[model samples]
Each structure stands twice: as structure tokens, then as C-alpha cells.
Target chain A: MTRIRIPPTLREEVGGAREVPAEGETVRELLDDLMAQFPSLRRQLVEDDEIAPFVNVYVEGEDVRTREGLDTEVRPGSTVILLPAMAGG
Target chain B: MVSYRDLLAQAKAEIDEVDAVRAKDLIESGDPVIVDVREQDEWDEGHIGGAVHVPRGHLESRIEAAAPDRTRPVLIYCAVGNRSAFAAKTLLELGYVEPVSLAGGFTDWKRNGFPVELSAGLDARKRARYSRHLLIPEVGEQGQLKLLDSKILLIGAGGLGSPASLYLAAAGVGRLGIVDADVVDESNLQRQIVHSTERLGEPKVDSARRTIEALNPDVEVVAYKERLTSENVDRILADGWDVIVDGADNFPTRYLVNDASVWHDIPVVHGSIYRFEGQVTVFKPGEGPCYRCLFPSPPPPELAPSCAEGGVLGVLPGIIGSLQASEALKLALGIGEPLIGRLMLFDALNAEFSDVSIRRDPECPVCGEHPTITEYIDYVEFCAGTREPA
Candidate 1:
């Protein structure tokens, strides 16, 4: 199980939960598991089957885009952070 | 009891005395802690290069701070040899291994054509105002002077800009240039502490200037009652600035500022806030990754909302903006490790802080090995999602 931390903007879609537990071996599988529970997250987090350009997913403080797109391995109990660009001053 | 001349002769006989030529040799050959035990006026006029000033009256109490290692050799001097001779005797009593007094002090050193350092020190008023900063070894008189000579420009005078401008002004950043097209709104008072209820209808730049001037008269504020756009960025940047603070409230402005800063080769201290969370980082052109490297494109309106759309916690900008001020100060003074390639995330609700590493992208449009976008484009249209990012 991976603990995925939700950003404030996505908390509404995640039912106001700061974190949610999911089961997966890679980033793709984890998001499949998470989006299965909440269907609306797909529109915000994904674009045409790839992670959205504006959204950054981090596995243990390392950006997945810098590592391996969606095929990045996710160990059990690893912390996943979903970060999106914010423009508020 | 002995007379003053008798005591002076006794002290001179006990301490080792070196002539001006010998003193210069010791200073050049080795790293001896040099002490000038002269009065403030005399020391300020001229003294040996790299000498720490400790007046004769305060020698016993302050010598340890000037030279903590008593085993190292200490070369003491004054206006003439008499005062330094007594000071050397005092150091020997305090367990110093070797205390050598200059035979003719600064007078002889000057006559020998050796180097002398003259301090353009602060006035009495400024000395009292920044006394606390002087006590710190890292931000001593030198660092404070650097701050007073620095020139920083701010993008906005709103939420994040309010606290950042206030703190930077209080720290005595010599020149501050503010760019904002908006006026002080009644709704801004919740977090925009730089403005007051009395100045609700005034322009943000004017209001901020008045507040900053009142806080610290040492600062000079330059007000630009216009938005930062490609057409005017060159004109504004032509004024010259050492550092830029970005606190704009929209993606278009943020992207424009980033591009301008990269082209101008100036470091930017960036801060952004959303409801309960904030982000802070320093975007140095060549040293670290820029905003384009971090986020290639802006999110669609549905995904990313401004603070106006999504209300922010009142104190969130205060925390993030103050962090920006600290980084700017460090950059101005050339001290401490700034957040060059690190992004700091602050969660107010969780009371937690985390950092992530950011790296420069070789394919970045603006700052890359082979740049494609050499000129500024329509930032508003680019951020409006009218066209997909390349």
C-alpha cells in the first residue's frame, strides 16, 4: 500500500482526505487504483493517458518525470506527492 | 606607588617590542591577529590593514572575541607605542602566549609607507539603528553596509509583496522598485499589511512606498503604477537591479517575470501561495533551474486557481514572503547557501515544511543549451490555454 498525499486543490475531489491508501507496483497502477475510487481525478491528473504537463508526481521526494514517466516503481509504504503549479501570490 | 612614567616603563620592559619594519615583516609572513588599541576617532581615521579595533578601555573585556586563540601571536598597536605597550602587558596577564607591541604604532607604520586602511564608517545615527546587526559575525558591519547598497525590484505589491517589501525595507535594502497596476482594495487588508484602511483607493505602488518609507527612512522606493509586460519590461529593467522578488498573482505575470529575469541575468526570489500551502525558491539564471525547468507550462484554469478564486490563509503569504526576503538578503550580502535548485513547500495546516530538488532542463525554451524562444511572446495568450505549450 502506498500513501498518496493530496494537494489542497485536489482535496475536494478526494473527499477532503489529506492522504489515501492505494495498492500498486508502479505509478500507473497506483493512479489506476486511486482514480478507480475517485473518477474525477483522471481529468485533473491525466491528459491522453499521460501525466498532465502541469502536474508533477513525486515518489519519495523525487519527481517521476525526471525518473521514468509512469513506469517508475513504487515500493510499499512509499509516500507519493501530487503537486500542481499554483499561481497565487 | 609608582608614577605614570614609571608604570609605562615597567610595562614596556615586560612586553616584546617590534619596530615598524619588523612588524610589517611579521604581518606579511604570518597570520598574526592584529589589534589597534586606539580611540574610535583615531582608529577610524587610519589603522593597519586587517587590524581589529579594540579600544584600550575595553581591551580586557573584548580581546577574547577579537582573538579567541590565545596561543596565536598577537600584534598590538595604537596612535603611538605607549598605549599598545600597556595593552600588550594586559594581554600577557590574560594568558596570551606571545604579545608583541609595535615600537612606534600607526605613526611609524605610516611613516614607513606601509598600507593603512581608512574606514568610511557609518554615522552615529546609523550605528545605533543597526547595532544588533553589527553584533552578528556573519552580518556584521560589512554585511549591513552591503544591504544598504543593494537594489531589489518587486513584481507586485499585493499579498506576498506586502510582507516581503516591509521586511526588505526594514533590513535597509538601499533601493526598492515596485511594479503594480492595481490599487489598494478593501479586501486586501486581510493580508496586505503594507496598506492601511485609510489608503484603500490609492495605487498599490504608492501605498507601499509610503509605508516602506515610514518604516525605514534609509530606503528609497521607486514606484511604477503599471503592470509588468513585455512592452515595458525592458524599460523597467533598464533602471538596474541586483535582485528581483516575484510575487505576482497570475501565471502570465509570473512567466513574463521569469523570462525577463533570465534575459537580464538577475536572480529572482519567487513566492506563491494557495489557501493553506506556499512555495518559495530562488531562480538564479546560471546557477540553478528556472521556472520553465520546474513547470514547462501553466495548468489550465480548471486545475490551477489564483488566490482570488481560491481564498488563501491570511498569514500564509506572510510566512512565504518573509522567506523570500531572507533569501534576497543572503544573495545581496553574498553569504549563506541560498535555495538555488531547491523548492521549499510550506503546509500551514500540517505545520510541515518539505524541500524538493529541481534541475535545469536541456530542452528548456528560454535557458537551454540552444535556445529557441529568444524573444518574449504573448504571455497572456500562452497562459490562457488558447494554444498548447510546446
Candidate 2:
């Protein structure tokens, strides 16, 4: 089991919980499991099978893109965070 | 000038980049101080909450004040990672410990749904009182509310405090705390306009409270009628003021105020006057010169005369304190430059105003990168050290 931290803006779609637990061996599988549980998060995070440019995924404090994108391995109990670009003062 | 490509390459080679996960871990573990090296405008739009703002252009100058410890872990980031790379390299070169650039800046941090903060809006009555300020696009409703929420501390009730308190109260500063241990004397009426003849013999803080209350009820004035010594300076200033106005008359209190303000990282609006001359500057810790940066040591008492000893023109405080008030307002509203890194001099005799550029001293005792005096010192003794046979 891995934990995904949801941001404030997306909390409503995740039953208003800040963190949700899912199961997977890789970032792609973990995200797939997360989307299966909360279908609304899929479109917000994925665009045509690639993580949207606006959405960033971090696996255990490392950006998955800098590693191997969705192929980055995630050990059980690893923490993943999803973030979208925020341009504010 | 070096080409951008070469500069970026050189900076990149000298620094290490941390992936977003490592940066997050550092933050979660509370082991690193996060710095946003973006322009002010970019910062106001959105930034990682709790990240200190030390823009890339001024990183070297301000980093010491923002993070005084050379051994603290620092996570530096910009819009992307490029500017932060240079910032990280500079921090390392300056002896900062464990400096790293966030691999992906706020852009990616946000895109991935990371937490970002937006400035909240203003309320209605405030919108009406500061409508004139709101007319200016820069200080519209958003800036007005910031002003209403700002806490300003004034160190004296004489001279400079007169005009500074009056105008700041009128400008709608939310909270103004005044510290004055003296009672209003007949001589104070010469320049301390905030205290009238009828208020003579009353504590200056009480006198000032009456004046501010009459001018604007919107402002709340907290009066501390005790002199600020090393013992109480820290406790009094601990409440967290947005800005501090150094209106103290003596060198000891001035140095005490400067040291405390530097230690707390609060910007101080410094003003002083002689018979026909006065000077004003915004002494921002680390970002610009603290008082000690300009005057490394206080002058010997024989040479340093207070306004009480050397007669001052009655209107001197009005001119100087008004300028202090303007600077405080600008600082609170976050609109216009706040006179940081520059000292403005006014000579009433010649009716001339001059500008002196002030640079932060990398070696300043109080705010230097390797600061020796992190805690408040016995300022009286420290200033007196300058008087010894030198």
C-alpha cells in the first residue's frame, strides 16, 4: 500500500480527504489504482495516457519524471504527491 | 558580461539539484529553509507557503538576513530551476551549508497539485476608508487589507514620533504600538506635536494615544510607557510587528532598536535629526544595510549630541517623521519602493535632499552572514565600546 496526498483544490473529488491509500508496484500502476477508486481524478491528472504537463507526480520525494516517469518503482508504503502549477502572489 | 549560457552552465556545475521528492522530504522533515528567488511580482501571484522571498538579483545581499545560520540547509527555487541553480551556487560560495536547488520550480510544484497560497481579499468598511488608496491600481482592495492588517511599532513619542504616528494612524494602519517611558515636558512641545501643552506631565504614550484616537478611530494604539532596554526589548518586540520606526533620541536606544530589529528580521524605518539637518532610511535586515552597516560603531558620547542638547528646528521632525510615515505606509501596502538600500538625507538649512547608496555589509556584526551577535546584546555597553581611546 502506498499513500497519495491530495491538494486542497482536488479534495472535493476525493471525498474531502487529504490522503488516500492505494496499491501498486510502479507510479503508473499506483496512479491507475488511484484513478479507479476516484474516477474524477483521472481526467484532472491524465491527458491521452501521459501525465498532463500541468500535473506533476512525486514518488517518495523524487520527481517521477526525473526518474523514469510512470515506470519509476514504488515500494509499499511509499508516499506520492500530485501537484498542479499554481501562479499566485 | 558573461553570456547567459556560460553563466548558467557554470552555476549548474557548481551546485546539486534535488528532485521534488527530496525537496518535499526536506520540508516535511523541517530540516531545510525554502527560499523563493523569484521577482516580487511573481512571488505575490503565488509561491510555496512559508518560503522566504529573496529574489535572485538580490540573493547574495539578503540571504544572510533571511537565513543567518551558515550551517542551515537551504532549498532555493525560482520559476524553473535555472535562477535557483545560480542562487544555490552563490549560497555555497558564501559558506551556506547544504544548499540545493529544487529540481522543478514552482511551475511543476503547482502543476502536480502542490500547496500554494493566494492572498486573501479585503473587507467592506476598510474598502471605503482606503478608497483613495484603492483608486491606485497597485493598492486596490488587496493592498488596503494588507495595510489594515499590518502591525507597526514606534520606539519614541518625541520629535519623529509626532508626525509618524499621526499620519500612520490617518493612513489606516491597523495596529500602532508606541513605547515611550518619558512624560511630556514643556520643551517637548517645540517638536513633539503629538503631545500638546495641555498634555504636559502626562506619559508620552498616553498623550500619543489621545492624538491618534482623535485622528482615526480605526487604528488601535497599544501604549508601553517604559524605556526599551536590553531586558525588555526582546519581550516587547516579540509580538511581531510588520515594521518598526526608530524614533529614539539616544544612541543606546537606537542601537538597541537596530539590534533587536535585525535579530527579529523586522524592517526598521530609521530617522534622526539635528538642529538643521535630518536623515531617513529604511534599514531592512539582510536585504539592505542595517544601521550598523552604515555606522559600524556608535559615536563617542561627547561628539554625539541629542536633539535636546542641540536645539532642532521645530519643523524638523515634521519633515523627517512624515518621510518615515510614508516609508512605513509603502512597506505595509507593498506598493512603491521602501527606500531599502539607500539613505535619504535632508538639510533644512539648504533646503536640499541627497541620496546615499547603502550596501549590506557582509561583515556587519548584527546582520552579517556569519553573525556573531545573534541574540540581543547589552547595547549600552556595545555603543560605549566606541567611546574608548580610539
Candidate 3:
């Protein structure tokens, strides 16, 4: 199963699971599975029905934004991480 | 069953033997050395009876003085355990295999029925030195330690230097180098925080030194009671400082500090205050760019307002100076992202902090490829446009 990890901010809606498994052939499908499981996170990740500009999706530590923007393929047993742009002084 | 955060803490806690009673027992039996890894303010308030103070950030460098023997067992603790974790890790990296952390830190020690010695710290006697800093969310213990371990050079002890030096010293920078040739003047007390009204006729460095020393005895205040010109800019900046604060009230000394800091490969924490507003930037050589990249040549003197000509608010320096200290500490600790490529602007009247984006200039004279300026230029000559302070 493809794994979808949650950030601290979004963990509350997903039953506090640090990571959850999803079934999908592509990154978009895996995200849809995650959103279906925890509906609140979908709005933050996808806005106006699109992925937020600042919310980045990374697969294997590489930004998926540079690949397919969100439709990038996801293989079974792969890790998907979502993070906000870190900016603090 | 611990979570990741708890596991990280447990891992750190596991390495530490947090029992102050055990530490007291160890000290009683002469089993280990108890090193207080907090800053001077923390150390001054109180520490274990036999504890030696060696700030965590400077742990690797000043280890020998605090713990003379390499084979002696050492127990280190901070206000809480986080910094001690870093201190213990640093010692371990330095081949201090026998050292262990005082788990839960001093905070836990007191909770566990251990006695805590109190220091005045932000609880200053006169208006409390740095009481505002304690209120800032980002400027707490982690920030305080960064302030303490930081090594910053202040190029002047006048108006701008007044606030910068006092706040930095109060925040607990381990070493502060003050360079100024002028003696304290009655007019200076209106702005320079380091010089008191009673210190009217004393050397500016003397006034500043006594202020910081009396405030936080943990800091090593060095005074270079001479004007910073081309002759001594490089020689004086030989301390391998982490940041250089240019609070000089003049453009020539300002450029001199920037150029020298760039040459030494240190971040120039530049702050220039005029009337109601101040501009600050971290010019790190070869990283984003140097000050020369933004202003290749010095401004034609009269255009810039000297603190004397423009008249600054007495409290304005306090705002900018504290900001300079914050930036310096952040640069030293290697924790949070640095303001290296960013310029923080403050408008006192409006009370606004706007971060302006700054990018590397390939055409920068100092840090650019095929750089024309190879060495520190003479400020006197450069200002005169006569012969570049040679």
C-alpha cells in the first residue's frame, strides 16, 4: 500500500495517525484516497479544487511539483510527505 | 510506546542521568564534573554548588577550561535538557565519551526537589535589563543561549552602539568587542544605552564595558578604545567573530566595518538608524552578497544623517539594537534559518517589521567573481574620495 504521512497540524483530523496507507496508481489518486479518509485535509491541500501553491507534496524527498504538479505517479510501498513552506526567524 | 517527539526526547533523556540528587552524590564523591551549560545570566542566578559555567554553544571551544582533565567524567545541564543535549553531543563529538546529560535539565532538577539558585537575569534592578526580550516568543531560552554563545563586534559605542552593546551584553553574548575612540559625551547619553548620564567624561569603551560587566558578568567585554580606520580594521577584527554590528554614527566607519567584515568572511549585521526609521541587513560574503553589492560606493556624506545632525529618539536605538542582537544570535546558533539573504526593516512610528528580499548580485564588487576590490579599503581615503583611506 502507498503510505501518506500527515504533518502535525493535520494529524488531529486523521485520528492522530502519523502515517496512513492508501490505494492508488498515481499521486493524485493517493491524495484523493487520503482526502476521502480525512475530508478536512483535502480542502487545505486542494483549493478551488486545485492544490495550494505553497503546500508542497514530496515523494522520496523530491518535490512532486517539479514533476507532475500533483498527478505524478505513485508506486506501492512509496512514501508521500506534505509540508508547508518553512519560514521562521 | 513513545511517539517520535517523545522518542527523540527519550533518546536524549536516556543518555542523561537527570537526578540532581545523584549529581549531588556524584559531586560529593568526586565522581564527575557538573558543568552548567546555560548562559552567564542563568549561571549567575544559581547552579549546582560545584558547577562550572561553560555555555553550551562554546562547549567545544572552552571545554578545557571548564573540565581540565580529558578523562574526568562530566555531567552537563541547561535550564532544561535541550541545550544540554546539544552540549553533551558536542562533548561526545570532541571525544568526551564519559560525559552524560543531567536529564530534564535544571528545570526538572528543581521540580525533583533539588534546590535552585536564582539569578536576576531579565529581572534587572533598574527597569530590568531586557524585560521586553523575555516577552518575545522567539527570544526565549533557545534564543537567549544563541545570544550568549554569539561573538559580535560593535564598531562604535556611540548612539547606535549604545543600545546594541547593552542589549547584546544583557542577552549574554559570550564575547563582545567594542571599538570606539571617543569618550562619552553628555549628548551621547540621550541615545547610547551603554553610557549612563553619570559616565559623562569617561572613555566610551570604559562606560560601555562597565555597563555590560555589571549587567551580566558572564560576558567577556573587550574594549578597543580607538577609532576604526584602515590601519586597524583588519587587525582588530581578528577574533573570528560570527557577526559584526556596525552601529557607527558615520558613513566612513560604516563602510569600513562592512568591508572588513566581508574580507574576514563574517556576516556584517548592519544597522543604520535615521530619525524615525532604521534599516538592517545581514551581508554575508559569497553567500548572498556583501554591502558593496547594494551600495558600491559610500553615499556622498551630507546626504546621510548623522545621529547628531538628524536627532534620534532616545528609545529608537533600543529597538534597532535589540534586533541586531537577535540577528547575531541566530547567525551563531545555526538553529532557525538566518536572515543572510533578507533585509529586516523597522519603522518605529508605524511599528512595522517588513522583510525585504535580497538576492546575490553577480556584479557585487567584494564577493563577485573577478572581484575588483581585493582588500579592505582605507575608510578615510574612501570617504574623502581623495585616496581610499590608505
Best by lDDT: 1
Worst 10 residues of 1 chain A by lDDT: A79-88
Query: What is the C-alpha DockQ of each candidate?
Result: 0.55, 0.01, 0.01
Leading candidate by DockQ:
1
Q: Taking the true A–B contacts (Cα pairs closer than 8 Å), what share appears in each candidate? A: 0.75, 0.00, 0.00
TM-score of each: 0.87, 0.55, 0.52
Which whole-number lDDT from 0 to 100 does residue B266 have in model 1?
Answer: 95
Give candidate 3's whole-model lDDT.
0.68
Q: Between candidates 1 and 2, which one is better according to lDDT?
A: 1
Can you give the lDDT of residue A11 in candidate 3? Answer: 54
Q: What is the interface RMSD of each candidate, in Å?
A: 5.1, 22.6, 15.1
DockQ of 2: 0.01
lDDT of 2 by residue, B1-390 (tens): 899999989988889898777677788886788899988668778887778777788787777867888898999999889889989999999999789998778887887787887635344566577778866646655567677788999988888888999999988899999998888888778778888999988988998999999988889999988978889998889988999988877767777888989888899998877666677889988678887766655544433444554467889889989999999989888768889987676768669786656667787788888877766655443223221100
Model 2 regions more than 4 Å off: A1-89, B1-125, B379-390
Whole-model Cα lDDT per candidate? 0.88, 0.78, 0.68
**Residue runs of model 3 more than 4 Å from their true location after superposition:** A1-89, B1-149, B380-390
Of 1 and 2, the candidate ahead on TM-score is: 1
Query: Over the stretch B38-58, how does candidate 1's per-residue lDDT look in tens digits?
Result: 987897797888888788998
* Model 3, span B75-170: residue lDDT tens: 888887777876776777777767877767787777877666554333344224444644444554435555666788987776567777777777
Higher-ranked by lDDT: 1 or 3: 1
TM-score of predicted structure 2 = 0.55
